[model samples]
Target: MSYDHISESLTLLQKDWSVDPILVDFMLGKRTDVTDHAVKVGQVIFHIPYITGEKKFILWKCYWPDCHNCCERQGRLPLTSDDLITIGKGLKYQKTSDFVKNETLVATWMESGPSGNNVLMTSVNLKRKIDETESDDGTHIRCRFLDEKGACSMHPNRPGVCYLYPFSSWLENETGRARVHSTYQFTGDCPGFFLEGSLDSMKETLKEYSNTIYDYTMKYTRTTREGFSLTSFV
Candidate 1:
């Protein structure tokens, strides 16, 4: 949870021959050559070239049930319109308004607009439990859906943010073409980093995550631009 621990872990990982040097460098801010390319599953052979200028392989596999750090430490779980609908239905909520009122909280923050000006944006995020859980750093709240067994209660219809844990993406327009660029979200809590993962499974995960992230971003941006309020859901 602290930078000191993260630094120590990176140092320990650096000694492991199984760990990829490029990944360690990237995490240490030593390398900034992260690639912005389309997700091509077929072209991938072994390592994902998320970072260009090198042939290094960085593999990861989620250690869920064993490690619920993401669920416990992730502060904000922003939801898109699709997530609202899907999760609402999954929870047996008769109306989106009811789900929004009972299960979410509206958060307002400043973000850069298209003209590079600061604009206030509001988002609907899944509400966390009120009780605080003590950790090595201090205390933090867990997602309301996270159970005592460290499993998601609404796993089948979890939000896009939950689906894309430890991986975040953004869209960039290059020569009038939209490109989705993804990067590892190193939180120092995920045990999956540097671990072996099946290429086929990784490809499938990337394909779904890529699509979800794109849709989530577009819908979230639209909601922000349209100035949708919590009352609008009703």
Candidate 2:
């Protein structure tokens, strides 16, 4: 929870993370990009851009994550009435008959920055923790539909930020060569991660339309919030 705790965690993973020009700048607290932008890893680039981390978490990463890139640290996704309906229907939570009755009990969703916050973020900010909680910031709360056993029953509909984890990249150097730049270097309790393919190969793996989808996803998020988090769910 202290600043050094975040920085120290990242420093521990010294060899694991690979750096690129863009990532290096962000990690160094220089320039930065929104999480939606594509990151150049190795020869290929990933559509998952520099999504933001938590503010305290960002402080941890900035000083710790051992990230030398200047990519944006944390972000929150916005919520729409449609998203609430889709999520509620998908999770079968507070059913249609109960939805109208209980809907008012919950706000459809709350907005923060580029990444949408979940209940988890809320509890943490308030010093409360719940295994079933969604990631949250102090501002809003977004809940994930759970399964019978209480797992993410509707992960496919999970927020874009949730999907793009431990994944961030940027065009480094003036040439902007795409690459598998920064790896998760946090020594914190973050889980393990590995790109399915080499950073370079992953870039070439995308289809034409896939790139379009990637670009569109980045459009809505803006650099509204400025704090960062150093925690990694991985």
Candidate 3:
């Protein structure tokens, strides 16, 4: 799919999402707690401190069914081996014995990023599995962990990419410094960019983190052949 299409889809989602009031208040200093290191909305956070003096936030709340559906419609979701195992063991998928142990399933699920880094299929598959599981849209896309409600069955054990959804990490070439980036704004449609209120400073911090993550991912991809894994990003 074109970059434009991806950007548009994310933009639409962003517009529909509402910033958590708890997050807004926390960032605005309306809510204070010495022990408060993160915001929790369905176990989410508006701020996550990775490095000393570096602060990040969950700028956009993950809108469940919509986000899930969008990814399916676009055929861009991915899954990792661990995700497969978790779903299989959880009794979420039928015929788990046949599919989970199949090495060919492993090979077919592999994906390569723009940097030629390889990763396992946790979401979309180009080669459709000839079974009731695969979608007929030609993308062969199916998230095995996705529940009937459109929520991830393995939400807690989801991959790093899922944790950093609508966001990416990058690394600087010269300083070797890392940063975070918001895919929403980079793609140019996050309403969070236009949000105005007493939370300006908080939003600015999020922006800084966004940029940092972008560089961090870039540097990470350069040195890591397997690409960023779920545990590492989390």
Candidate 4:
């Protein structure tokens, strides 16, 4: 599924809160009032929001095995070049082409370009177990790597999108750094969001997630510009 609407909303929200003291205080854990703020890295707004209510900011902690909501109903898990290489290696595929051909589907969709134009981008998505008896509404599908115990069989070498689960990132402009965003706004069903967690811990997680996303994005941009498909890259 395309995330153009989410990006557009984040862009508008950033504009609205260009100089927000409420968000500042919220980040510092000093605000008791309810409000929403986008997570950011060095002034680059992330799509994830820090939503507060009932005089406290909501925090999240993944409840993986206990709650497999994300894995069960995941819509699209786009794979990056790095993810392809790592997963191919883990699966003992000697050739990336062989792995891609056997394990993934090439998905192409239109998204809003950096300059507000439309661009068609192609990427590889991990294939999911298809249930012929079920409706094709995406709700009945699950990742192929998801095991019976609700654990990822390819945990150590899962795709980049899986690693960044419950969160996503994008560069607002081609020249700017990528910003992090929570997948909460889109999914709205993650049980993790209802639980309480440490703000510092969340920040630390965002730091790692943001860095990984930035690296993957840079590699993706370079590979696409070089006229190589994601699956063809090492």
> Which candidate ranks first by lDDT, i.e. highest?
1
Better of 2 and 4 by lDDT: 4
Per-model CA lDDT versus the true structure: 0.61, 0.33, 0.40, 0.57
Per-prediction backbone clash count? 0, 53, 26, 2
Model 3 spans with C-alpha error above 4 angstroms: 1-142, 176-194, 197-223, 226-234
lDDT of 4 at 40: 66
Q: Report the C-alpha lDDT of model 1 over 1-234, residue by residue, as the tens digit.
A: 345655655664445324465565666667777643334542211225355555434557777656677787665767878788899999899999998888777766554443356655456776776432222112235677888998988987888778767766544576996655555666555557652332444666666566666665566656556554222211
C-alpha lDDT of candidate 4 relative to the true structure: 0.57
lDDT of 3: 0.40
Model 1: how far is 74 from its true place, Å?
Answer: 1.7
Off by over 4 Å in 1: 1-55, 109-121, 130-140, 195-205, 225-234
Model 4 regions lying over 4 Å from their true place? 1-58, 110-119, 130-140, 174-185, 195-201, 226-234
Q: Which 10 consecutive positions of candidate 3 have the poorest summed lDDT? A: 43-52
Assess candidate 1 and give its lDDT.
0.61
lDDT of 3 at 100: 50
- Summarize candidate 3's per-residue lDDT along 1-234 as a digit string, tens digits: 335554454545446565444443333334343231333222112333222222433334334545564334323333344444554555455664544544113222443342456644333221223342343432425555566777775567554345554554333233674322223323322334332233445555455445445443443354244432331221
Q: Considering summed lDDT, which 10 consecutive residues are worst modelled in model 1?
A: 131-140
Ranking by lDDT: 1, 4, 3, 2
